[model samples]
Target chain A: MPGWYYDKKELRHSPSAQDGIDYKTEMRYRKEGARLIINTGSKMDLGYNTMATGVVYYHRFYMFHSFKQFPRYVTACCCLFLAGKVEETPKKCKDIIKTAKSLLTDQKFTTFGEDPKEEVMTLERILLQTIKFDLQVEHPYQYLLKYAKCLKGDKQKLQKMVQMAWTFVNDSLCTTLALQWEPEIIAVALMYLAGKLSKFEVVDWMGRNTKHCRWWDMFVEDVTMDLLEDICHQVLDLYSQSDAPIHPDSPPLHSNAKQQMPSLRPSNGQEKTLSPDRPPSVNAKGPPLSDVPQFPYQTFTGAPPPAAAYASVFPSSMAGPPGGPPPHLSGPPPHIAAPPPAVFSYVNHPPPFSTVVPPGAPPYFPANAPPPGQPPQHRPYYPPQ
Target chain B: MSFEKSHTYEALNRIGRGAYGTVYKAKDKKTGNDVALKRVCVPLSEDGIPMNTLREISLLRQLNTHDHPNIVRLLDVCHGQQMERELIMYLVFEHVEQDLSTYIERHSKGFSGVQIRSLSREILNGVDFLHSNRIVHRDLKPQNLLVTHDGHIKLADFGLAKTYDFEMKLTSVVVTLWYRAPEVLLGLTYATPVDIWSIGCIIVELYSLKPLFCGESDGDQLSKIFRVLGKPPESEWPEENISIKWNSFNVNSQISIDRICPNICETAYDLIMSMLTFNPKRRITALEALNHRFFLEEPINT
Candidate 1:
């Protein structure tokens, strides 16, 4: 059961190192993340394990090799690509390079000096090799397994906990927490939090249709702040830091910037569109299960995202030091701006109040999600600034 | 950019084209291991290799963890160079012969009882291992089953297999139209029993040189099944919500198995009949079928 996600180098490195958990290192991750966001000129949901993959890659890369050996820019790209692959939110190399070129437009592209594109591309390849081509990023599955095993005595409660935890892990991409903690810890924290709010705090509200009332009570006992604290402080945001450019020389493109990727570049309707129901290719069908081995997606929540722009969340946190500012720390946006960009705000371990699913009963979900009779938790949707 | 690691291999002829990549039979220069190198040599565009790469990745991950002389093992995954985004997944196995389909096509004229039994047991062994782990090989056609030089049968290509979590079950059209099961044909929520239908097809194919349930459409396909095995009682079919009418199969009037194979032992006929049952709840599970009299008296390798 020991997976490739378990990295020894990461365990020994500072910051990302097991004991390297602290305030300063966490803040740097956030700052660098903002640089990536500012570079992209758009905001990713930073949800699920997208940001987590970025941050975790940073934490892992810094373990064995230093900035001396691997430049931060290349390392940054590695983190992003690796994390993107893990979270199943794969981004193209062109976008990655564009981000790098723009973000470090001023830095004398130390690796490829003249052509920033080649440098970023080359760095991306190196990162792919470093990770041994294993893309089964960890997610809430691992954490839920542990939680499920702990609640094995109570199958009914465990089932509910697993589903809620799954929802948290599934949508963690919406928050910056995925950038910080491992999926296991995040899973534990999410189950703990959900158990507290809907399952426990409002037991009177949760109509116990079956004889599983006592099991619900014990769920509350299982939650611990010690665990919650790790999720809160360790899971970080990259944009909250100073690297995020709040003013956006030209305000960040509104949601309608039509930032269609090159591969997805819209057609001028000159050619007939292929049927959306076109069959999966024969030889190139679906997930190959034949000769070469692949990692199960169940363990996809491990690695963190590369650099991001959530640093604006900690506009002040990303500054060189406390009061003395270099002027870029204004803010990422308003609501999602709480956590910085570089910081690994993991999805498994979401922040306290950012409801991935609003605080009401959704028709699709049947958890402590109010009654079919009750109204669903309706919340306003805001595009990421 | 350093191509410092000059790894060489004596590339031989291409074995076959998978959904996403071209598989080559090759020899490693240093180790001399007969490696099945799958090369995803294509652009990253829509026309590129299909789910072949991912299918290989997903299937091999689990099969590699398993140790069965009959199961294909995935050794190493190599992503090399700029010519094309090629992924060379190295496997330590030899290309014995053409796949089962080729073998059946050329030699099914009159497969000796022993030969048929041996093929069945080997196929069953590999299938049983997969089922025990709750993995269903959605595609179990002769094309995906490989025969080793020593006459051992190895199951490969799990691209269409369904691994259900505690939440949902994927019951899509995973098998080739010929080998696809009946429920999947009816668009019902199937579990592992679909594999049983596939096994039945393989069983008939062993005797008949043709695909047993081969049909042009879903309706025709089910008609072929009803022709061989009478329709399931309405009470047995919980598919009242389904719209693919049973009459569409045009077999409310019963038909006979003699029309399909005409040549097979009574026991083998009975087994196939049970396997091709429309009700998945009634299909023979892998282990239960293994204990049948066919394997008990027929020639079977350990």
Candidate 2:
């Protein structure tokens, strides 16, 4: 008989919930691993795999076992041991105990030159105890791999997106939602989050004609504007690095937004910075929304530009030449009004993604809701970018 | 057991739980079919949910043809999630109010050989159809056999069933050990006769209103069977007769199958003996078992 504990429902926002997990821990895990793996061609590593297994196992163990009662490290160790068991090359019990000691000690466990086999034995006992001795919940990692399989052309970009998405999963573990979402959705959200961050060529694959996904628009807005960009900010703080991938010369990755949306890709080859039909202050540089002109555009960290400084970016649009209000913000442009209250202000910061309310749907994550750290699900943020 | 059923098939109560999957009673919105939906949830680690889902869909697309009256039909497959896990596959089964275990529980006084004859015949009929189609119901027990409110016995649980494709050689230790055939207990590879052994246990359950050979250990179970029909003979049970060898229980074992229940008629005894035979090759098929004098001679009315 198949041995699986199945819960198909979304657990986020369940009436009763636990103290949320911090998404940063997941970031630390991925950052440490990704720093070494990014240029390394995503080598298959037993370390990260085992680490992820431990994290997920620890995560699920808490689903039934309250975090209030159990030690998180114990839970983490349990997951690692369980993973070792499933991986089939289990270490001796004493090595597991030692690993646990090393994992918890001041001069904590470092995987460098130590006998990895011996270390695992010292760690196994505590891990087993944390697991309450049951190890049937091991899940297969094929979902992330299968999702990377593309139905369209230009597979390189999709592969790149997989890495970015995995980054999201790791970072998402820091958020309280992980405890709520199933592994599949968590994985999908990561892919969705990374796609939003990268604005990859596969964006077109997520639109109207995309089979089985009729809710593309909603998915985009909720995923992108809400979770993804926020996740990118949370994980990579890549708002500064956004322009590099946009450059067309990059191999495998198409820097042009048009590459992502063939429907909207400009055919005339005109630059968006010069387009007259663009928003007022069409060419406004640095922090597309800011109006401050104190520093040169290059010096600005998206420093908000003033209404007057914006008009200088595009001379033709500012002149109001042929029946058009200067594209720049002279006064309150009828579109976006004055800067209102900060949802949860962080100067260069975007709001926490959970609060993104799709047009018809309720907030993906309630802004007013107290932050519950990582559970399982982070939040659903569909990206249209 | 609570059901809003006809409206939304809300899964209000869980009647049965197991490692294999959970069985819930649901209602088909349009047709109002009171369906028992068994969801098989296999764990896929950090990966996405698409592949397993597609695999289940594709396989069911082929296997869904098992719509016989005696077979538990797969009504529908659900994937689009609601609030929870939308990745689950919902398999629909017609409402067979009670399974054999439940039926026997309610009918504790037990059935006479005449009544047992018809029920056993129906059970055999289901098994006969499955074997002929090359499907082996690997986990056949009273729990997998449903007795409808009308008292019809239909076989269920295709989750563990496998096709006898000549290319693939599978293990035999699948069905619950209590109902396991001797060949299976020894880890040897046998065919549908293993299912027959389960049917034998189920048949005895139906007759005596109690489990037959319900031992906790495999050794205890084999001994119980031997105490009844005598140990398997070495001549009949060649270690190579099947795929694997269980030296402890192999060759001249002379296990018996007598103490299971007493005072059974010769015809019923003969039918059970044929099914409980250690020599799987000699064990009668469901069709032959159906033609046995027990079923032919005694027609069940009540």
Candidate 3:
């Protein structure tokens, strides 16, 4: 059975389960850590492609290994570091380390940093092995620009809508949508949402207005309405919970420990520190908020963050729409149940060529239409009377 | 679960070696299927996994998703501890009977014109798939093309393959020297057209049993090309503003199809010439090459 099956079962466990912390709590911690790393990367002027790829890498890596085996923040930094190199927008290793360390230190968290270089470098190797060195990742950003160009509309409004869709792609990365859907599908769905929000009509690939065509038809033939709806819901879930506080264990950013992350490297062959700032109730099911210093980071400023400001870097909400949840978000995920394994099971037994639909095959071909220029596949015979 | 190399596969005799690693014939313990496992020893130091191996792994996985018939399949990936605490990563691929180079060697004189047409068609199909996916197989040559026992061809060895972005800059140093395109030899940034030139050279080799342009150095390579096809008109080098300094040589437009290979059909000759067109823009695309009369003829299918 896949790890996801175990994760689904674990999600149903009550808060009082017998453990110091449940998997849900651990997952939240890691997701937040990844989000912070992405924000820091963006602050460092990394391209959105690199940031998107890094978060996707972080998600895929965790599928094979749990948060307990590796420090989530450290892994997040390593993923960004590696993605920067893979995307050909290489960043100095020291810069990545410093930015990540500063973010964690501001948040009052700690992990091994005795040899920050060696620790990150070691984790980078492990990451390469975990994903089996498959580093090329496709992103929806490029497709958004392409689709926006193909859609015939007011140039200025389309530009604004494309920009909005671009943000939607960035925010969707915070969730598991990248891992679950094809980049094209994500791109189309986000464009759909952007159009709905902007009141502009999204067009098909041929630059025809999409008013009469099925919304899904505007996309490549492989995409289905169900696939787009599932992706839309996943993104919607992210927006719905945008106003929620950061993971409970995350320390407020105002903590004064500027050098809080623990140094993991051995010094004089002595024992390494496991975590920074040990609390009196270390064994408690959850950490107390009392020790966390009050901070003014926009996330914790107590003013309902402007939907645009929050969504600016990583929008959590899609507000100002005419009504409640768009008609698409109220349904269950697409019937395409669990996201397929990161490395497909089909690796061992690939699907045969006979089953491969040609690249542009219509979603639903006419039932009686024979394949173009070819005889009907069925065997012909004179009926016996 | 980790793909435990030792538990799943037991290695057989070593078959070949290259810059990255050694290739061994191995058996899948569970299915008893034979696989060609390329074992690359990746050191655990700061350099991490070599970028070339990473490129190969990612490209193979991406191509394997669609599983094109003419592209080799990557069956599995595994790693094991080697001596000196080094890590050996094994890329398991479907085993083939032989490669194009070996097939030609076994035949002594080269393949028949019909066999050349069929093989060229398969190569074009495989190249078409890669190009459609925005990938360029930078090092396409005869040795990299594998042949199954039943005479099917599959393009293999993607160490130099990369996904191309128009604005991206790439090193001109790719594809073997002999098969390298003129723009690449001239130190200009080249793209998918380079592969077409290399395929042209391979097609000639397939028909004549030897390399058409056997130049010892980059300079000599251009000379050989100019000697046979004459100088590429000034308009051909528009992207490259400066003119090429060619050796004082005579134009040889007289070298016709009959002179090159009298046995080759006219359509095959036409296709080869189009691929060898000096202008990158004019060079035949894999898709267009597939539709050439050379491939449409009945001789290619049988």
Q: Which number leads on TM-score? A: 3
Q: Is the docking of candidate 2 incorrect, acceptable, medium or high quality?
A: incorrect
Candidate 2, residue A170: lDDT: 41
- As a whole number from 0 to 100, the lDDT of residue A378 in candidate 1 is 24
- For model 1, report DockQ: 0.05
- Using Cα atoms, each model's DockQ against the true complex is 0.05, 0.03, 0.22
* CAPRI quality level assigned to candidate 3 from its DockQ score: incorrect
* Best of the candidates, DockQ: 3
lDDT of 2 by residue, B33-99 (tens): 6778775442222222223233333344345465666776665544323212223345556767888
lDDT tens readout by residue for model 2, A6-88 = 33242332222344534333333322222222111112223334444555555545444444344444344434545544444
Chain B, per-candidate TM-score? 0.77, 0.78, 0.81
lDDT of 1 by residue, B181-218 (tens): 87787787877898888998898888777787778888
Better of 1 and 3 by lDDT: 3
How does residue B263 of candidate 3 score in lDDT? 64
**Per-residue lDDT of A169-242 in model 1, one digit per residue for the tens?**
43343333444555656766766544432232222322334644433333334434444633432232211222
Chain B of candidate 2 achieves a TM-score of 0.78
Docking class of 1: incorrect
